[model samples]
Structures are given as C-alpha cells and as structure tokens.
Target: MDLYITEKPSVAEALAKYFNSTGANFKKEKNCYKDTKKNIFITWAVGHLLYQNPPEAYNPEWKNWKLDTLPMIPTIFKKTPYAAKKEQYKAVISLIKDATTIINVGDPDREGQVLIDELLPANKKVKRLLLNALDETSIRKALDDIKDNKAFSGLYAAGDCRSEIDWLLGMNLTRFFSLKAREGGYTTVMSVGRVKAPTLALIVNREAEITGFKTQKYYNIFAHLKINGVTVKASFVGDRITAKSEAEKIVTASKSSELKVTDVFKKSNKQEIKELYSLDTLQIDADKYFGLSADDTLKTIQKLYESKYLSYPRSDCKYLPTSQFTDSPNLIIAFNEAQLLDVKIPLPNLRPPVFNDAKVSAHHAIVPTGKIPDLSTLSKNEKDLYLLVLKKYASIFFPVYEYESHKVILTNGKYDFTFTTKITVNSGWTALYKNMPVSDDAEHEQDNEVEISTAVKAGTAYRVETFELKDAETKPPRRYTEGSLIKAMNNIKGDTKESNNILSKIKGIGTPATRATIIKELIAGEQLSKKGKTLIPTEKGKNLIAILPEIITKADYTANMEILLDQLEAGKIPKQKIITEVTDFLNTIIKQKDSLKIVNKDFPCPTCRKGFLMIKYYKDPDTNTVIEYAKCNNAECNQITPAKNNKPKIITCPVCKKGFMISKKNSKTKNIFYACSCYPDCKTVLSEDDFNKKRG
Candidate 1:
C-alpha cells in the first residue's frame, strides 16, 4: 500500500480531489482519505504534531531555574507528543507502519522536509514530493518530480539544529536572566528568545534615540542663477557649512562672482518592475499600504495561496524558474478577461527579469497560478492583497520605465550649486501602478526641484541674480512602522551606498519565512507595543534589553548567525560546529549573572487580559496588621486570586468555559459571590462557598 503525507488537511483535500479527477475512487475517513482501488491513502499532520520536550523532560534538576543551574545544556534534543494534537500523530504513525512505501508531500522548504522526516520509521521506502502549489498543473508537476527523501538530509539537519539551538538558548537564557531579575527585587519574568531579543532591542534603542534627541538649526545657502530669461533656484553644494556666518560667506561670495554652467549631464534610465513578492516583502508592502499587521498579512497570503489565487506565499526567493512561463499567457488572458486593467494584455510570450538570473530557492516567487476566484466573495483586505500580487506579476509584461535625468553643475570658481530635472520618456511598467500604494521610487526622491530646462547649453555664462538663506532644523530618526521595521529586519546592514559596500555580504536577522513570526512573537510577549502604526518597546521591554548582553542586542551578530545556518544547510560544516558556536556565545552571557539588571514593570492582572495587578494595603491601627493583596486595575474583573506556578490562578466558569470567575459583593449580606468573566453574556452565578466547594 502507498501512503501520502501532506502538511495540512487542505492540501490533502487538494491531492484527493486531483486523484479523484482521474476516476480514482476515494472514501473519506475521520483522519485520512483512502482510494482503495489504487491502494493509496492521503493523510496530513496539522502544522506539526510533535514538539521539542521541555528542560525537565531531559533532567529533573533542570526543571527548577536557579543561579546554580544557570545554563541547562542538553547534548541531544528530544521530541515528544504535543498533547493537543496527539491523535493526529498516532493516526499518521499507524498509517506509516501499515504502508510499504511513503510519499512525503511536505512544503518545499527546510522546515517542511524535517517535519515529515521526523515522523517516519527507519528503513521505510520514502520518496519526496516538493509541493509548491495546490493548483492542478502544479500538483501534477510536483508529483512527476518525486525524489528520494534522503537527498534532503542537510536541509533536515539545518532545521533540527535551528530548533534545538532555539530550545537550548531560549530556555537557558530566559531562565538565567529571569533569575537574575528576580534577585533585583522584581516580580517580572523576562521572556527572552534568540530572535525576539534582538528585535526588542531594535525598538527599545530607537525609542531611546528619539527621547534623547535634540534639534539643531542649520542654514542652507542658495544661489539663484538667471540665464536664457529663465531663473533657476540652485542650492549651494560647495562644501560643508554649518554656521550662519559661513552660509552668509558662501552667499556673499557667490553674489559677487558670475556663475557659469560648468557641466550639463543627461542620462536615460529605466525603472524596471519591482521584484516579485517574497513573504517578507509582501508583509512589508501590506503593512505599508493597508496598516495590516505582519501576522494578519501572512494569514491573508496563506488564504490566497490555499485558494489557488497565488502560487506559494512563503517563498524567500525573488526570482522564478523559466518553466513558470508556461502559465503566464493563461494568467494574462484571465486578467484581461476579468477587466482587471484598463489596457488589455496580449499573449504573455514576454519572458522578463522575473525569470532572468533565476535565484530560485525551494520554490519560485509568489505568482498567480492562472486562477482568479470570485472577487465579490472576498473581503476588502483579501481582495486588495490578491490584486497587489496579481498586478506585481502583470507588471513584468509592461514596457521598461524610461526617463532622462539631467544634471547641471553651476560654479563660480570658488563655490558651486547644482540643479537637476527628469523628463519621463515613458511611464512603462509603473503605469499600471499610478495612484497605487507602492513606495516612492528611490531615483525620484534623489532628485531636487525639477523645473529646470535641460536644453540649455553648457559653459553658458549667468549672473548670480539672487541669494537666499533658508533655515532648517535637523530631524531625529522616525519610529519604526510595521513595514519599515520588516524592511530593516530584512537588511541588518544599513541601506546607504556606504554601508552597502561595507556590509554587502551580511545576511538578514531572520529568514523571510520567520521574520513576521518573530515580530508577532515579540509583540505577544509584551516586549513590543504597537501604537497606531509604530512599534514602541514597553518599560519592561526596555529593561530586558538593558539586562541582556551587548552581543545579544546587536543585529549584525544575529545576521552573521543566519549566514552560519545557511552554511550548515549546505553541508559545509557539521551541526555541532554551529551549535558549539551558539552555546559558547550563550555561556559568556550566562556568566554575567551577577551584573545583569532590569527595572520591575507592573505585572498584568491574572484574570483579565486587559488589566494590571495593583497592591492595596488594608491596615488595622490597633493590631498594626495589614491585609495585602494585589487588586486588578479593571473594575469589571475584580478577582483577587493567589498566584500558582508563578502565573495568576485561573478559576474558570464551569458553565460557559469563559475566563476566570470574577467575584461580586452581595450588598445586603456583605457576602461574596462569583460570576463568569463573560458575566452579562453568561448568567451562571455561584456563591463564594459554592465556588470554593467546586474548586476543592
């Protein structure tokens, strides 16, 4: 019997439907679909059914976090059943045991390779099917190219090492710093991560910069030259001038001397279509244009991909393979038939840069699979994102954006000024994106005021007609928006020409597949606060960074670690090589147990997600005894529950399975009663005695 293991249930359905199309009969069961005639079974694992075991699972002594057990190093990581998804694990395992041959239908990535490989028993016949898209054509293509599972051992090793290292460092470092913080008279427990720490640091450091920044006044000297009866305002770019007196000197000097056009340069340039969407780039664009959170944007991408409106939403590669050109004509025809664009697109015989250079990864870039869903049924955001990807793909067929850039260098022997302008030869590929939410073109922003006439002859003499001094204040760095933050995460090295030349080889902090998740995790752990569209670190987040070692906070350090992960994936180095490097680096920070520090922030209320814990001292003057307990800041949820296992005690409503049972005082009797957190909605109430009895 043959078994097919897919990544998720939706994929199994797609596969089952494809086989059914060929007149293969299938009987849908509880956990799997079976085609008895062909002796084929299709099953799925819900994301993942097994997770890495906790520290206590390895050693009992490592369970309790203390300074003595500062670094609980584990030589080998183990995987145990995730309690919530154990049934699926058992189902997959049971099927694997029964089958003679197993086909691994995981996503085409390192993580996906490891996910299915970990489930199979040794010596079983396993073939790999790298499924990029669920569309009929793609599924058929992937099915035809099945290879042996062992061919991806390095990819699996890289993925395993990534998880093990994360568990080792995340668990150990979080314990070490949290223990140190406990000694500092704080009840705060720091939740640290390998990627989360550096991401939080970015926010905290940016906030500090903004808070401490001081505005500085600066002066600009302008030399307006009159030539050919046209007056052109040119800023003096002779030399660095900060002082008002110095700017005055340049204005005076240029006023007394005749200015001549020393050089006139004109160059034609093309703004090619922006590259196709990588998952990270798509998230960035979605956030920039629609204020969608990274997590939400990713969900939308998945929805579109699963619906067959997109190819693969989690791709890291920007380039596509030449074979993807087979569907372009149909996709263009679909676009024109749907009336998506004003100008009807011809046959997509045009093979553009998307297929050129071909830096393809596990899958090609996210492109349409020549399928368009019913537009009216889609939500506004979904419709917007779907079209965004569709238009980006369509842009490749448009003409190259052509423009002429003109530069005029005016000099008075001692000082100089410059003017520049652009003449749009053709709108080209960008014509499709007019009034679109795409970012301003970099070349367009680099140019100055563009009213100058490029037809003027060079070396023409002109009088320095007028001089003006403009005052400006230097601006501080802006806060990181969700989009801008993702952009920064993609390139840890600065974006300037200077930094590009210096740090061009440096990799990003995280992969396109993991960057959004990192941001989402940081926000969920309360290390990052979202205000409007900007990201700000909370007080607790700031203190966590302060307590962390300088090496952990540096983006370049994390970026370099990514490069090592890549090297490990390529089988260039042993897994232990990267593990030892990370462990050694972690040990140095762990040794700083004595020096670490963090300020205590108000702890969240145990019951309600929105409230915080506040202490109230009830004093009896005669005995000098005070009844002290933390009260919730929220008036609605006034549950004064004791702490259990370091987290707030949760006494849930037995009837509705809502949140913790908040207490209410009976006005007549002065007795307490309990009600569900969803009180008005769920009118299940109980007396204090009844609640205590039920708890017991």
Candidate 2:
C-alpha cells in the first residue's frame, strides 16, 4: 500500500480528490481516506503531532522553578505527542506501519519538513511531495516530480536544532528569571525565549528612548518675498536657532527688506519602481495603507494562498526566478480578465529587477497564481489585501516616476536663505495611487517643495516683504507600530563582537513566517501591547528587561543563533556542535544567576493581612483567558487580587453594593473599566470616573 501524509486535513482532502478521479471511490475512515483502486491511504497531521518535551518531562525535580535546579539541560532530548493530537499521531503511525512506501506531503519549509520527518520509521521507503500551491495544476505537477525523502535531511536538521535550542533556552531562562524575580517579591512567571527576549528588548529599548527624550524649543526664520509678481516662501540657510536672541538677530539683520538670489539649481530625477512584495514588505505596506497589523496581513494572505488566488505567502524572497518570467504573460492575462487591475497604462517590457534566480531561496516572491476567484466571496479585508498584491504586481510593469527638482539660494545682509520646489514631469507608477491619501512620511518629505516664481534667476535681487519666526519643538522618536516593528526586526544588524560575523550574513532577526508569531507571543505574554497600530511595552515587560542580562536582550544573540540555524540548513555545521555550544553557554549563565539582583516590592496583602502580596497569573480554564494578579504569600491563606493595571481599588461597587470595585482591562481592545471584585457572581461594571466617584 502507498501512504500519503499531509500537514493538514484540508491538504489531504485536496490531494485525495485527484487520486479518486477514476470510478473507484475513496472510503473515508476514522483517521484516513482510503482509495481502494489506487491502493493509496491518505492521512494528515494537525500541524505537528510531536513536540519537544518540557523540562518537567525530563525530570520531575525540574518541574518547579528553584535556584538549586537551575538550567535543566537534558542529556538526551526527547519528543512526546501533543496531548490534544495523540489520536492523529497514532493514526499516522498505524498507516506508516501498514504501507510499503510513504509519501511526505508537507509544506515546503524547514518546520514542515521536520514535522513529518520525525514521525517516519527508518525501515519504510520515504518520498517527498513538494507542493508549492494547493491548486490542482500545482499539486499534480508536484505529484509527478516527487523526490527522495533524504533530500530534505538538512532542512530537518535545521528545524530539529532550532526546536531543541529554543526549548533549552526558553525552559531554562524562563525558570531562572521567574525564580530570581521571586527574591524581588515579583511572583509572576517571567517568560523568556531566544527570539522573544531579543524582540521584547527591542520594544523596551524603544520605550526608554521615548521616555528619555527631551523637548527643546527652537525657532526658524521665514521670509515672504515677491519676485516677478509671484509670492515665494524661503527659509534661513541655518534652519533652527536654539536661542530667541539669535532668531531676533536674523530678523533685525533682514530689516533692509531686500534679498538677492545668489544661485539657482535645477535637476530632473526619477524614482525607480519598487521591488515585488516579500512577506515583510507586504505587511508593512498593508499596515500603512489599510491599517492592518502584521499578523492580520499574514493571516489574510495565507487565506488567499489556500484559496488558490495567490502563491505561497510566507516567502522571504523579493525576487522571482527567471523561469517565472516566461509565465508572466499568462498571469497578466488572467489578472486582466479578472478585472483586478485598474491601471490603463501599457505594461512595460520584462526587466531583470523582476526576475533574478540568484536571489530566489526556498520560495520565490509572492504573486498571483493566475487563478482568479469570485470577488464577492472574499471578505472586505481579504479583498483589500488581494487588491494590494495585485497592485504591486501591476506596479512593476509601469514606468518610473519622473520629476524636476529646483533649488534657489538667496543672501540677506549677513545670512544666506534657501528655497526649493519640485515639478512633476510624469506621474508614472505614482498615478496608480493618485486617489489614495498621501502617506504621512511622504507628506513630510515633500514639506520643503513649494511654488517658485518661474522668472527668478541667479544673481537677481528682490525685496523681502516681511520676516516671520516659526516656533517648533523637538519631537521624540515615534513608537513602533506593528508594521514598523516588523521592518525594524527585519533590519536589526548585529553590532556585538559575539554576533557580528554570524548576524551580518543573516537577513533579519526572524523569518517571514515567524516574525508575526514572535510579536503575537510577546503581546500574549504581557511583555508587549498594541494600542491601535502602536506597540507598547507593559510594566511587566519593562521590569523583565530591567532584570535581564545584556546578552539575552541584544538582537545579536538571536541573530547569531539564526545564522547558525541557517548554516545547519546549508550543511555547513553539525547540529551536535551547535547544541554543545548552547549547552555550555547555558551552564555559564546558570552559574552567574546568583549574582543577579531583583528589587523587592512586595506589599502587605489587603485580603489576608497576615501575608504579603506577590504577583501571579491566573487563567480561567473555561475561557482560557489568562489574567495577572497578586496573591498572598502564605500557602494556607491563598487570597488573590488583580495586579498592576487591573488591581482593585478601595472603591465599593455601586451595582453590587456588597463588593469592592476593581479596574479590568480588555486585552484585545485595551479598554479600561471597573468591575465588582466578586466576579462570576456580582458581575457589575462601571466607568472609571463613576467608580472613583463612588469610592469618594
């Protein structure tokens, strides 16, 4: 019997349909679909049925976070079936045992490769089915060109190393920090991981920069002059003046009311068309235009791919393979027929920028699969995102934007002033976005572009009508939005000696598929937050960074690890060597754990006056909702109270007269409200002011 295993049931179903083309039907069983005529047994795993064992699984003593049991490094790593997916794992194992040959039909990525590779029996003949798209044509093509399973051994190694390394670091550090924080009277679990730590550090560092920023008041002198019956606004050569006295001096010196144009410069420039959309760039643009978060953009695009309207969405490559260029005309024809494109301009000739095989990695750039779907069937967000992908596809075929820039320098009695203007000679690709709102950054970039008098010439003198002083203050750096954070993560370069060589060759801090997940985890762990598009670090997050060593918080550390993973994938280094190095590093850090200090801030427990309060997180098993709270230190008197932002106040509930009111914040919406302390019983909620007034 020939066995076919897929990453998901949907994919298995899709593949089963093709094999059941004959009159001989497919019998749906408890765990698999059997095609009797073709002698094929098709089954699927719900992502990964197996995962790395936690520290507790290695040894019972490692279950509790203790200083003496720090750095629980298992001499031999092990895998266990996810409790929720054990049935699926057993089904796959049973099918593998019965089959003469097994086919691995997983996603075309390192994680996907490892997910199936770990489950296979050494004696069975294994083959790989590399399906790029779920469409019938792509799937059939891949079926006809299956390769030996051994071909993906390197990818399996890379994925295995990544999982083990992450498990080792996450389990050890999370335990170490959580235990250490107990000394400071902070009882909440201080979770830390290889990727998550550096990612959180990025937010915390940005928050520091924002908080430390000092606003400085400054002034700029502007001159309104008339030249050839036209009014033009010019600014002093040295723009900002720190002192009002200096600005006043410029105004006083300009009392002559005459200015001479010392020099005029004009030049034409063109902005090259942007490259095609990689996952990161696509997420950034979608966030900029449609206000979609990085996760939302990724989810929507992934849906589009599964729906066969687009190719694989998790690609990091921005350039397409040269062979794909040959198929571009057909794709363009399909796009046009779908009425997806709004551009009326003629498509330009195929250029090298759009197709370069050298730059193509595991996957090519994301583009339309030339498979059009019913427009009405897609949701508003899906339609918007699909259109975004289509526009970027169309953009490459449009002419570059061309404009002429003009600059003029004028001289007053003792100072020189300057003016500039830009004339659009051609809209080019920019015409596609003529209807959209100008981006905030684009508007700022063009702030200096003003209307200029055509008659103005070099060495010509004109009368200055008046001098106006504009007051401005320095603004701090803007907080990271999900989009900008994605960009930052992608651009983070290693500057530390330990990571410089490794990280310099790595493209970004995280892969295209994992960056959104990293951000999502940070938010889930209460280490980071989202206010609209802006990402903010929570008090817990700030505290975690405050206590964490520089090595863990630095991007270089994670970047170096990623480079090693990449090297593992490329077969440059053995997995054991990397594991050994990581183990030694873990041991070194574990020894120094004693030297780390945590500031104790425990307060006497209000609920149980005999005990002090320590931070803790509680999850409602029914809802799977996690809430951080303060708990009494005494084991016998286990009284709990909400923590930090949601900590209860002295106010009495108006609705539930017997209970006190506590502030409760919605995790997703970030809205604050007051609820009765006796939740699930006296479920009373009030406005912040109302609660405060009631307390008063």
Candidate 3:
C-alpha cells in the first residue's frame, strides 16, 4: 500500500476524493483517509510536526539566557515533536509502518518541500506528488506525474538552512543583546531575527532620514489661462525661482500677456487589470484601502482559504496554472451563483494572460476555489478581504481602461508654462476602484494634471487670467505607512553603491509569508509605535540599532544573505556551511567588548514621571498563584498595580493634560478604573468602560 503524507487535512481530503472517483471508495478513518481496494492510506501533518530543539535540549546550562554562557552554538541541531502534536506524529508513524511505499504530497514550496518529507519513515520507498492545486483534476494530474522525493532535496535544504539560520541568530543574538540590556538595568528582552533585524533597521533608518531633512524654500508662478472659456492652470517651467522677488516679477509681467499654446501632445493608452495579488500586494492594498495590518490581512485570508472561499493564502506566486485558468469559467459561475459582486458586470469573451503553468513556481496565486460561502455568516474582516479578492478576480472579465494622456505647453513673451492631464476614453476596469485610496500610480495623483478643452488648437491664444506666485518649502520625507513599508520590503532593489553592486541579485528582506510577523513582532516589542498610519521607532528600538553592527541592521546586507539562501536552494552552497557561518558570526558579536546602553533610567515610571516602577512577581500564600505587578518606588505615591504584559499599562490622561492614566482597582466593586498618576494634584478618574473606550 502506498501511504500519502500531506501538509494539511484539506489536501488529504482532495487527494482521497480524486482516487475515490477512479473506482476507489475512501472512508474517513480516525487518523488516515483509507481506501482499502486502491491500497492508499493518506495521513497529514498539522503544519510542522517537529520543531527545532531549544537551547536546553542541547545543554541544560544554555537554557538560561546569560552573558557568561553567551554564543552557545550547537554543532548539530536536534528536533522533537511538539508536546501537543505528539499524538498526531505517533498516528503518522503508525500508518507509515504498515505501508510499502510513501507518497510525499507536500505543497510545492520551499517550506512545504521539507515539512512532509521530514515525516516519512527512513528506508521506505518515497515518491513526490506536487499538488499545486487542490482541485480534483489537478490532483489526478499530479499523481500521474509523481517523481522521486530526492529531487526536492535542494529545496528542502534551502528551507532547512533558513530555519536553522533564524534559530541560530534568534537564540544567540537575542540572548546576547538581551543579557547585555538586563546588565544595564533594562527589562527589555530583545527579540532579534536574521530578517527582522534588517526590517527594524529599515524603519529606524527611514525615521532618521526624515529627522535630518532640511527644508528649502521655493517659488512657483501659476498661470491661469482662459481658453474658449475653459480655465486651465499651469505652472512655470525651465528654471526654478528660489527668490520670492523673481517669482513675483514673472507673475506681474505675465499677468497682462496673451498665452499662446506652444504645443499640444495627446497619446491614447490602454491599461488592463493588474496581475493577480501576490500576498505582498494584497497585504499592501488591504492596508491602503481599509487600514488593515498586514498580519490581520493574512489571518483573514487564511480564514477564507480554510473556509474554501479562497485558495492558498501564503503563496508568493501570483500566476495561476493553465488548467486553473481554463477552469476559471466555472469559478465565475460559482461567484455569480454566490452573488460575490455588488454590480453584475459583463464577463467578456477573453482569456487572461495570468495563467501559465511554468510561472507557477509554488502554489498558484490566491484565488476563489469555486466554493459558495454563506456571505451572511462571514465576519466584517472576512467579507472585506473577500471583496478585495473578488474585485481583482472580476476585473479580468472587464475591458481595458482607455485614456488619452495629454500635455499642453503654454508660453508668453518671457516665460513658458505646462500642464498635463488625461482624458478618459473608457472607464473600463478602473470604474470598480472609483473614490478609493488608490495605490501610487504616477498619474493617479490629482495634482499631477489639469483638465483642458480637447478641441483647442495648437496655436490658439487666450488671456492669462488671475496668475499667482505661491511660496512653498520642501517637506521632509514622510514616515512609512504599513502599505508603503510592505512595498519597500517586497521591492528589494537598493542603490548600486549601497548594495555593493548586487542590487539586481536580491529581491527582499523577508518572504511574503514572514514580513507581516516581523513587523508585528517589532510593534509588540515596543520598538515601534503606530501613530495613525505611519510607523515611528521607539527609544528602545533606536538604542538597539545604535549598538548593532552594520551587517546585521543594513537591509542590503540581509538581502545578500537571502541571495545565499537562494544559492542554497539551487545547490550552489551547502546547508551546513550556511549554518556554520552564522554560528561563527554569532561568536564574533558575542566576543565584542562594547556594552549596549539605553538612554532610559532604571524602570522610570511610564505613568508618573517623578517615580520609578519596579516589576515583581508575587505568590499568593493561600491561592498558590503567581502574579506580577508594577510598584512605584516613591513611598508617598505607593501605588501597586497589576503588570501589563510585564510592563505598566500606562495611558496618557484624557482629563489631566500633565499626567498619565494608571489602572486602579476599586476595593468596593473590585472593578478597575483609570486614575491620573498625579492623584491629588489632578484628581481625574474614569471607569474601566471609559478606559477601554479611550484611544491612546
């Protein structure tokens, strides 16, 4: 019997169903999907069955993160099944023992290449089934073209190398820096990562650039010309006027002049729907349209995928399999039956170019699985995300956007002015996105163009009416919003000199699968704080980057490391070498003499500026419970409050402008209320309901 191991339950069911259609009846058993006559027993791993052994698993002494035991590098990493998933692993082993051959049906991605492959029993005949899609037809096609599992050894090594690299750096460097922080009287546990370090560095560096930007004043002369009663606004060109006097002179001189149209250029262009959403693009759009965090978007998409409304959400690839492209008509039918669209747009008799089998490197782009979901049962987040995908899916059936990009140059006796605008020929696919916060298309900004009469001749003259000189200063670089930050992460091209001329070789810091987690982790660590849509680094975040070596923090350097991983995947480098090099790098950093110093004093109170808060875990003698609290050091202000995730739950007071809000439990009601830290000086208190309702 051939035992098939899949990464998840859905794939197992799909594979079983496909075989069932081919004259075999598959029954849902306790552990494996059983088909006795067809000699197939399919089992699955719930994500990763085994995890990398912790520091203590290697040496018990290394369990505690200490400066003395720094750089505890294990030559050979060990693995153990998770305590919770041990039973599933046992059931898998039980199935494997009775099978003659095993079919590895992992998703055809880097991580998937190794996850299911790692679970197969040794010395058993193993074959690989690259099930790119869960559709029955795709599954049958994959089964017929099954190859030896050894063919994916390189891909497996790449994924394994990436995991071990993260573990090595995360364990040693996080411990090294965190221990150093602890020695310096800080409670910060620095969660470092190979990819995360560079991501944080990018945010920190961008903030610095904004801080150092110098504002420069400039003047522009705006010419308002009334041609055939249609007023068109144009800005002065050629040399920029830095002096207000020069700009005013031009405005005064051109006020009474007749503006002659020097040149008129118009070119018709067509824009089709954008390529399907890769996880990166989808995350970006979700953030832009709905202010949804990349992490939240991924979670919502995952829910949609599991609910069968969508395909794989973690896929990096955005191209669909050719078979699935041909299968799109059925999906259209399903979506229509499910009433997926707000308006019933006409489906054109055309095939989209997004379908190419060769382009589907991993799982195909996230798409509808032709399953009708109960729209009423979906959460707001789920519905919002589904709509986002639905729009893109439906867009391919619409006509291309046709527009005439027009530019007109106007000239007086001494100065020349120009204005550019687009005249819409057809609304096409863009009609779906009207009145939305659009992605940064160069022509998308309203300020980029002005409307003009399409009938105006090249040599037509008009009176220069109501011209003005506007003075403006160059603004500093804007802080990165979540959407723009994700775009930056995905677009890995750096300046040639900055990236050591390897600009074209590397793609990004983190994969689509991990970038959201990296950003969320940074925010959770209090290294980053979100103010509105923009991200600002906290003092702790700034301090950590200050002491870190250039190699760890620079994105290009990490991107180079990503290039190495790609090489590892292509069999250009050995996986052990990658691990060994990282271990050695950790050793050098741990051996450094300088100590990390943060500007913050010893637990300065987050609420009260006058006092410091000391965190302590207390044991209840009667209840035998261990609970943590932050107690103020000032004897007069002896305030004891429950610890907020090992830190004080300090919020700025809404009533009192000078003090922060501290949680106080009422002795009578046993309910929490927020009180001003200033207390008697500013006796402002609010109920817990108000506390939860207030925004920071």
Maximum-lDDT candidate: 2
Q: lDDT (0-100) at residue 221 of candidate 3?
A: 77
lDDT of 2 by residue, 1-696 (tens): 999999888678878787666354777888999988778899999888998987888899988778898777788889999999999999899889899999998887888898998999789899999865454565666778999999889989998888999888888888888777766566467788877877888888899999999999999888888765666788888756899999998898788678888888988899866578999999888888888888899999999988978777888878776656666677777677777656653544756387775666656688877678788999988988888787777777777888777798989758888888666777777767766644554325743457543535788888888888889888888888888888888877667655765654555577788899989988987778799878999877888888777787887777677778888888999998899988888888788776886643336655446776666667879799987666666778766555655343355666767776666788898877777777879998887577556644
Error of 2 at 193 (Å): 0.6
Q: Residue 582: error of model 2 in Å?
A: 2.5
Residues 264-325, candidate 1: write the lDDT tens digits.
Answer: 89888988874798887888788877888888888887888888788767777677766667
Instruction: Assess candidate 2 and give its TM-score to the true structure.
Output: 0.78
The parts of candidate 2 lying over 4 Å away from their true place are 1-46, 82-95, 102-109, 127-148, 225-232, 255-260, 337-342, 371-378, 412-414, 442-444, 451-466, 496-501, 562-574, 592-595, 600-696
| Count of clashes in candidate 1 | 0
Clash pairs, candidate 2, are none
Model 3 C-alpha lDDT per residue in residues 557-670, reported as the tens digit of each score? 565566788788788888777777887788788887365443344467655456767666779797999877777766677566556565755567777787877777899988
* Ranking of predictions according to TM-score: 3, 2, 1
The deviation in Å at residue 671 for candidate 2 is 38
Q: Rank the candidates by lDDT, best first.
A: 2, 3, 1
- Superposed by TM-score, candidate 3 places the C-alpha of residue 388 at a distance from the truth, in angstroms, of 1.5
**CA lDDT scores, all candidates in order:** 0.76, 0.79, 0.78
For candidate 3, which ten residues in a row score worst on lDDT?
Answer: 439-448
Q: Considering every candidate listed, which one attains the maximal TM-score? A: 3
